[model samples]
Target chain A: MDREEIRVAVLRIEGTNCEEETATSFRNLGVEAEIVHLKQFYSDMIRFEDQRSIFDYHCIVFPGGFSAGDYVRAGAIFSARVKSVLRKDLEEFIKYNYPILGICNGFQILAELGALPGFDEDRPISDRPEMALAINDSGRFECRQTLLRVESRKCVFTKEIEKDKLQIPVAHAEGKVVFPRGREEEYLEKLKENEQLVFRYVDDKGNYSGYPWNPNGSFYNIAGICNVTHTVLGLMPHPERVTFDYRKNSFGDGYYIFKSVISYLEKI
Target chain B: MITFLFCEKLIVFMIADVHIELKEGVADPEGESTLKALRLLGYKRVKKVSSVRVFRIEIDTKSKEEAEKEIKEICERLLANPVIHRYRINWIG
Candidate 1:
């Protein structure tokens, strides 16, 4: 028996459209990946009233898409549903140290659920119960292949890239990660120190500075961030869409993210 | 004829768009539409919304002195992006 086989579960809800690409990416990297629809946990289809425990899987993914049709704000409606309905299961899964990735809409959901940094780990919930992914600095949706500098060395998804920068594609309108007042530099500094600041917007030369080179105009050119534990990561880029050789834009390296995950699983 | 009343002059709401700009190369059509929607929503009373991102701030400061200082810091640090987005302050007590 091949114990080295890694099992990953790509979660699919009604509006989710990236599971196939994400699954394909994982499969191409020699990991056993499966697309599990949210309906499977519940016998009914109309409402997301049913969802089972997610402890069976080693890795879970919340792929990109306009989940819940971006109603009541992007990812807000769907994330509320998930947090309220599957709260216990998700909490348990995290307690066990399971790996989770939220891309785009998924990132929105994670932040809304207080599951990204789980600020409670450091501060009381009363201080700030709600988090926000504000409108882009450009005041618009940015869609194109852009360069991202891998700044964090502690995350599970980005460890294998090793390189200081990665050229990945991004498609989003509300990709800004904003916290309360007076918390910008401190939050970024903490993320940097924790190695949770995984990806940053950069230029062709891998310099993380200036406009046009940095899309969305994230603070400190931030593109992605992970939780304190590194088991959970939330990013603005769509790695699943460009995880194959043919999908690469002008730059041709997108498989390393999946490769890194698989490599970690193999070692385990 | 419309009747107008004057008193000690209470501060009325002043609409301010806390514009946030993406990097020069970044694209943002949604932000454009939002500006359009603001116009369609009958916000024409104000001169030139200019399609910038807007954030509503509610604070209690009896004096304009304290209000200006607090709001400026808020916008500079969190409410607006200093690098890409420039903020215009409007005092509404």
Candidate 2:
């Protein structure tokens, strides 16, 4: 696979605001990236010529933003719509080891879709969600800069990240990742043992911290994770927003996310 | 309005009251915020606050069992997230 042959789809719906930047991030890396509407994949109203399939692209990105106005819980509406319509396709996508990236609300959507913490390769997408992004313990939206330490080499998205820690921005109300009630420790242990935990929130000193440092109070200071197969990934920070700095003429920490996935697709 | 006209009288269909809430031990930020507001308003004795989102759905179904199945699917697939939420459904017509 060549870099020119890699195709990325930045999945979007109403109220999803980060598709443009996300698509630009991929395109900046010299790959064919398109911001595609979810409806175009399954809506009957869509014209035949414009209709598309998940197989059309090598990677699908669920970008950030308040999808479906964050009603009935953030990302619930979007995830439900996706699961109801594209469940089998997405499951197959995961099983095939095609990269799937979700940022912020996209992270919530993937979690809601039961595509994260994919502990079983034979069953990548569970019938019920294995984890969720709940409202911040602060009881309000948290938007700030966060430091994340790469915790897993197993994830495809962070393998090329040159730094051990990345300074990225996080903005969301429901960013606290939680497992089923009372079983958080068990799942955290499993995630650790499997090397699926991709990014852990760190403080200024580069150590796992709490509160504003952790941003959403995510358990185990986790900021991002990948499935067991390392095909599907989700994180709370907006990697697209900080990919490059024009004046500095240098890549930001988030650049490695898009770069890593594209390299993986190209190499494979 | 058209349903009433079709029935000639407002004969009601089955109604479902679905309560969706975070599972026990999960934090409820909205409920906590509400509790904080109440405390500010001088409600001193409030020990705890819990929140539930209740939805009333009306469906035209022939049997209680059938309605139960459909509503359960609706709750599981949309109204509630099984990972962090547990839902209960009550039927009335």
Candidate 3:
């Protein structure tokens, strides 16, 4: 056993609900994965005193769950705490081009923190963040094994993933991608031109259809996106849930994403 | 003028401050309702409509400005969609 395997840190908040599964996924890939509780990382008595800096780990994962009870929207409250405490550390992490993955609720948190698409340098919080995870068009929680087509060749996390579509699972009610009022065209064009859009929903026949084709009704059927440097990734799919071969459905390709993450880390 | 309306006679109204552009491809259900209502009242050429909602919350604070500032965070994170909604507070003296 390689004792000095890649150090993977799974960030856990008070109401966070995906620590165990996230740990298991990384451990299976021969990585040192640990669930670090946010309270333990931060001081008990005051704010920002003992907060765990993102620099402590090689790869940081904001895993899925109902963080902060989704009280003030899905990930707003938790993301605000992270921003307030670890803002400088997060900026350095992004500057150094370290890998950061935000899955499901984490994606929403990342968007709220102005970490996705990477256009929020020194911008006011009142200014709307460029991307959003709106309520699903169907307006219901959907939990099913989903198929995602790898669309971008630039993302480091998806580098080893097959160029073709891969099977994964998506379980969420708010996953639709929305841009600021009049910036839809410009945003989509920039995302596509820069190869930031990493995945899209596609049918088994490889055709981009509707409803299930774009499970959450995201614009451009976008299922995942990465920052310009491809070091930061945010996706709606629950890749950790389907990392094992046994968990695969008859047509599941879930293992590919885990494999991709492992391969990317090894290269780095 | 201050008589209370009975159970079925209650009148409901909402005030909103939407921060959205009337661009194509965006959905405005509230605006659509207003347009339809105006049409029913025999008005014509109601080219466009846009709207928002406001809720006045009273908290214990001497400074109205400070109170508004504090509540804005709650509103942004909870009540209002920062993506398309803007809010201002009005005090009733």
TM-score of each: 0.70, 0.94, 0.77
* Candidate closer to the true structure by lDDT (higher is better), 1 or 2: 2
Each candidate's interface RMSD: 8.9, 1.1, 4.3
Model 3 spans with C-alpha error above 4 angstroms: A1-3, A44-52, A120-128, A247-252, B1-62, B73-81, B88-93
Residue A206 of model 2 has an lDDT of 91
- Alpha carbon lDDT of each predicted model: 0.67, 0.89, 0.72
CAPRI band of model 2? medium
Off by more than 4 A, model 1: A1-5, A42-52, A119-130, A247-252, B1-45, B48-93
Model 3: how far is A16 from its true place, Å?
1.8
Overall local distance difference test of candidate 3:
0.72
Put the candidates in lDDT order, highest first.
2, 3, 1
Please provide, for model 3 over A78-176, each residue's C-alpha lDDT reduced to its tens digit, 9 standing for 90 to 100: 787877677677777777767888899989888877788775434312233556677676656878777788997678787776658777889888788
Question: How good is the docking of model 1, as DockQ?
Answer: 0.06
In candidate 2, stretches whose alpha carbon ends up further than 4 angstroms from where it belongs are B1-12
TM-score of predicted structure 2? 0.94
